[model samples]
Target: MSGEPGARRRRLRELLVDTAPLRQSPAFAKLWTGTSIAQIGAQVTIVAVGLHVYELTHSTFAVSLVALWALGPMILAGFVGGALADVFDRRLVALVTAVAAWLSIGTMTVIAFLGVEATWPYYALAAINAASATIMGATRGAIIPRLLPTQLLPAAAALSGITMGAAITVGPAVAGVLVASVGVPWTYLLDAVLFTGAFLGILSLPRMRPDGERRSAGLGSVLESLRFLKRAPNVRATFVWDLIAMTLGTPRVVFPAAGALVLGGGPVTVGALTAAFAIGSLLSGLFSGPLGGVRRQGRAVTLAIAVFGACTALFGAVLLVTGLTDAPRDADTPLIPAIVLAGLALAGTGAADNVSAVFRTTILQAAAPDDVRGRMQGLFYVVVAGGPRVGDLIAGALATLLALWAPALIGGILILGIMLILLRTARGFQRYDAHAPTP
Candidate 1:
């Protein structure tokens, strides 16, 4: 794809106006709607779970344990689930996973309604929910490429970013309100209701099968995808780049501590900080009219990541200055400037991150073979989804070892340094073209 002749580089104005073919595809619209709805519920549950766990134990370690609890099962299930997506009907895989997730939410609702104060049950239910969601995401992501034409892949990715932005924006804010007003039980119940849309979305897709030899539905299939990743230089590079960004820039794990110790705003502050970032992402996607078609997407991803790192570094600098300067950490005192500046920095990070996401997803869908797309998408999801949780664990641990501000400052510097090294080392990824297949 080439730009208009002699066109001056503008302020991503295409992102400001609507363009492209995905909006015309009814099937894509329906899928986007349903996924967005379910995602809202998913985010609500995430906030509720954290609040509930903290309420029970009042331990930051307990909150971090949520990630540790869900990590292994999600990874293992994601791999097998991706294989199932390849071997069986993609619709069936998604539908079944949705059902499992719905049931998990329902079960949690019952537990909360029954007045179970024990934290173990919440952990158990969260692990189950996380596992199902991992599979559902893998299947759903792989299905998008098949539902639309190749040219519309970027549009689909942009739309998907919009859905995520909406979900994150609505879900956490709703979770905050519901948890504050109606309590955790009602939050889970609301999620149960909201999840119905995803069921309808996946239920309507046409039957799909792997375009290759159907292998046994087990570990062997997963290993096959792993081997493929090893050879796919561009795909591998995408994962590496994303891992660097997520691990180095994910500041969310420090939010709760920031709320309690640094900012003196408590849980409400934590939720607001989370929502502010999501709001930025939503705004970016809503204006993403021209993101649909682009060439040299690899460069776009690298640039986005660099911007993300810069914003994150700015955020850390703000926190460090505030902490070492006049900002008070007393329980009754507030750091208004620090809070406002951090929110702005996080918002910028969200927008840059979303842009990278739009390009990275397009590459994943267009470059990989359909027969093994599920596994590749699963790995993609794992990197994108799981990487942050792992980052959360790192941030949480580091925050405990040092100060709430330390993790962000160190993580930001690390992300910038690693991304530069990766960009310099990876040649094929830098040269990747949106129209061609990767090998």
Candidate 2:
């Protein structure tokens, strides 16, 4: 109600995800476009790195080590990069990390072209690339709120959901074909070149120093951020609720078993289930215009999360029913109806999760102070990185001990119950206002 006339008007057509965010700010437009391309390129390298390492070592465990090596560095970078973002110009921090990632990609390309038989180099480079990317992402996230007015935060977050959805959905498929057709070397080279799009965006940005007190990049600054998160109920809500939802409801661990066991479609069934989630997220972004007008963002996030819980439960139920009333599945014939039903349920979960992401991201950027925002985003990236893995573990444990569908069934119900309770009791979060973000 407080924006410009055009924003206030919000034409009926605009209700279907208009391009107002892109049109309103050229800086944001460039950064968004560039980051979008960079994510696709990054995904390409992520997949290619796995394939390359596997080809060299011929061991899945070795391939797993590549990811494992990246994890430590990425976690460290969150705190360090955040502190750096708070101390130095964010533009500088982002640029440096982007270059580091690009350099690592370029090195991988050269090594691959030279037919390096050693696996250690690839492992080292992959870790560096992942860490640099984490830093870049954290710095970039902190920069978004500065680039756009508060009114446009929801729109920007929605666009980000679209960007991420497309990257994850399209990038892996392209990487598979590219690696198969050309080789790992070319894939690395392509990623290196594509990442220049990120540079273009970073280079275009002006010097962005911390707005308030400057903090040194160290343990104390990081601790300060942790303390801030503890005190800020709204901000804490974003992470706590997200962690609960992910830890309990991640159904991906059962995808393989579900496909081969009850579903009987094998890898194709697994692929379908995975793609359905991304498709749902994409669809939500495509129709995200209405979300921009929501003023009570905390409530919006709560409702979205609650819906996610229901969907997860529904997904589990679909699997449970299929497993119960199913005939002996042939390897050649999949239970098409069950697969469709399960995919739809997962899709619903994806959409609801994305809706929660949109509001939560908006809240983080809108509510958090500018000086330490980078570290906050870094912490967010850590959560983003680790939450799903924990969720997968929960799913795996439940499926191992009980039924393949048990994780979703039990986890979803838990999420629903906890969320409903929180909605009634967490008065501050329930009453949080978008116009005046508390966190």
Candidate 3:
């Protein structure tokens, strides 16, 4: 058809080489390990902060406000951080931002130890942490391509998912135990310690200048990304699809309330549910070798998202059934079956979402021009980071007004339906080739 398919496949193998050891590259391996360890700590703080905030306020609405407070700052930081990454050495940018986040966590630890019950300071620190994290997140994505070969991007992405899944799986559970046994202060301190791994990783990385002229970091760079998006239809579409998938399908906003109502109990249920999603994602990454070899990454992304949506719907259905059976709402009653089933569904969703992330990230990294990659990556981070938050708000509203299951079920169906429609109309996305990515 297009050429000798077998030869192309052979070339792809040479580039990707599944059995090739990642450990051979000390820099790549170190970066991966460092980020993974740091991620675990980050998750602990996530759970701990929520618990701390809730304990002080005892209001679900207030807990949701944390998301809102962080949203705008994160978006602004992502855009500026990206431009900064393009201009300065990315490694330095990442390290500085990481230190900022670590210090914020450390500060929180002190506040907790002081027995400060005030919520405003926590909220302020959370916003600062989020902003720093946004910068670090964008810089890291830009860093991966520099560390590994182009062909290995998919494999690297898969491996990243594995680390992320592991972190997610353990972080919240560990946070719960730490908070319960020791206290919130300890959780914050632990995160501060774990944060060292990330710092070490970035510090060890070589200096990385932009591929071209270092663009000035200002409105000029930010405007460039927006202008590029206006012209780059495929990249634009990918963003839209991801935004829809995350905005519609993210079910986490309801987890706390579900624990209190549908799933029964308190933070324990929340941790278990979060762990289930990570477990599923980890399982997928473990089997990601086959996925790395696939072509047509765009279609692959669409299919993965559709599967995610379906599984979310299944999770919702399970919740509905549990509600109908008059499931336990008390902190005392066991909801083993419901929790397990929901976990299964979340796991499936996690796997599918990871697949989508691999393709979407690859497209952005490969297609975008070097000079503009930072800003574009930043905007991409904003959408990627912000979408779930919007979904959280939506989920909260739906859960408050209707049954908890209503959001997942309705959102799932909407994601699937919208994806199908968009894919059908945008034949270009379906026809996208992994070997020859378009900007």
Candidate 4:
């Protein structure tokens, strides 16, 4: 009986997410701590910005223009910032970009307090903030591989998942409360304060210069990274798979319509759906211990993404059922069964996406040479940021033409089919081994 208890404890330990990366690297620990905190503030600002825009224009389309205005600049900054990270001191680049982002937030706070009602200022400031953030993200992602041993890359990725989960989950909730109670200015001011934590973390890192020949930060360097990607089939496959997943499986664009027309919970339902997805992601990160031990990373990524598609499809089915059943559409009427089903399905998607992210990130860091890691990470950021925007467009257009659930259902099926084809044809990606990490 005593031996059985010991075995049970061992099993539990194996199931929990590994924390060795945090304990072993002081710099990483500090960086992770600061990023996690700052990300929450960032989320608050994101939500607050949207809310403020809506308040000014009383139009959802105008509010969405905020993201539209920021997207192009953010994507451009990602590539440029990534090239710069390879040429300059990565730590310095991150620090400077962090300060730029903080200033943008400060500007927003000032605008709010001064009662600046002009929409153009909000658009301009948001664009600056988004571009700065893209640069900082690209630089920081490249810095992680330097901070830890190659073997611990998966753990670092898992930790990042936890950070994202926490930030998305806590930040929006707090933002909603603050915006309702104190106001948008207070929310922006709080983000400005939290921004200091990120600045300190970057400041604490030692200077990190490129380990190989430096590339100039321009179109040529970006083109060079693309040429390298052409030869790196496995790394390229990671990007392709993620783009497929995000562009097809993402369903956030349908949430507002789902809540109002189908799910019958209005804003409360939308919040619950979003929270459920984040909660699942957080739980997956918490229990990601066995992920680091997985040797067939390519297979892991494929399987996880397949699961993601399946879950998204299930969510769509729930929506379809709710719409067909003539479920109550009023905000006051709760379609409990459909709502529960949709939430669970979305949660499953969150878990699957997090698992896929850990492997995809680990593969990128492990396979890419240090010389072009920043550039590769930069391209990764572009895909990460751009895919969702494209997905939003696809989902919105499809949902408008067919039904609220049509995009998710059709897109999920498309993701699964495409992934299968890729798996069958892309033997290089399928055979990729974490232990060897060949690109």
Candidate with top TM-score is 4
Model 3 / residue 333 / CA error / Å: 3.5
Comparing 1 and 3 by lDDT, which wins?
3
lDDT of 2 by residue, 1-439 (tens): 4676767566645767757779988888999999999999998888898888888888878887887888888889888888889889999999999989999999989989999989999989988998899999999989989989998999999999999889879988889899999988888888888889998788889899989975578889999999998898899889888998889889897987898888879878998998899999988988898998899898988889899999999999988888898476655679998999999999999999999999999999999999879988998888877788788788989999999989999999999988999899988998889988889
Q: Compose the digit string of candidate 4's lDDT tens values, residues 1-439.
A: 8699999999998888889999999999999989988999999999999999999999999999999999999889978988988899999999989999999999999989999998989898999998998889888889999999989999999999999999999999999999999999999999999988897679879999988975678899999989999999989989999999998887899998888888888999999999999999999999999999999899889989988898889998998878888556887786998899999999999999999999999999889888888888888888998999999888989998988898889888888787777778877788898889998
Candidate closest to the true structure, highest lDDT = 4
TM-score of 2: 0.94
Cα deviation of 51 in candidate 4 (Å)?
A: 0.7
TM-score of each: 0.91, 0.94, 0.90, 0.98
Per residue, candidate 1 scores C-alpha lDDT tens digits across 1-439 of 2565425345455546343444666666777788888999999999899998888889978987887888888887778888888899888888888999999999999999999988888888899899899899988888988878877887778778888898888787799899999999999999999999997777677897878786787878888888998888888777888998898788887787777777767766776788777877887788777666668888778878888888888877776777677556764566777788888888888988998988888888889899888888888877866889778778878878987776778888777776677578766787888877574
| Model 4 accuracy (lDDT, Cα) | 0.91
Alpha-carbon RMSD, candidate 2 = 3.6
Give candidate 4 misplaced runs (Cα > 4 Å): none
Task: RMSD for all candidates, in order, please.
Answer: 3.9, 3.6, 5.0, 1.1
Worst-scoring 10-residue span by lDDT in model 2? 8-17
Model 2 stretches astray by more than 4 angstroms: 1-12
Quantify all predictions' global Cα lDDT against the true fold: 0.82, 0.89, 0.84, 0.91
lDDT of 3: 0.84
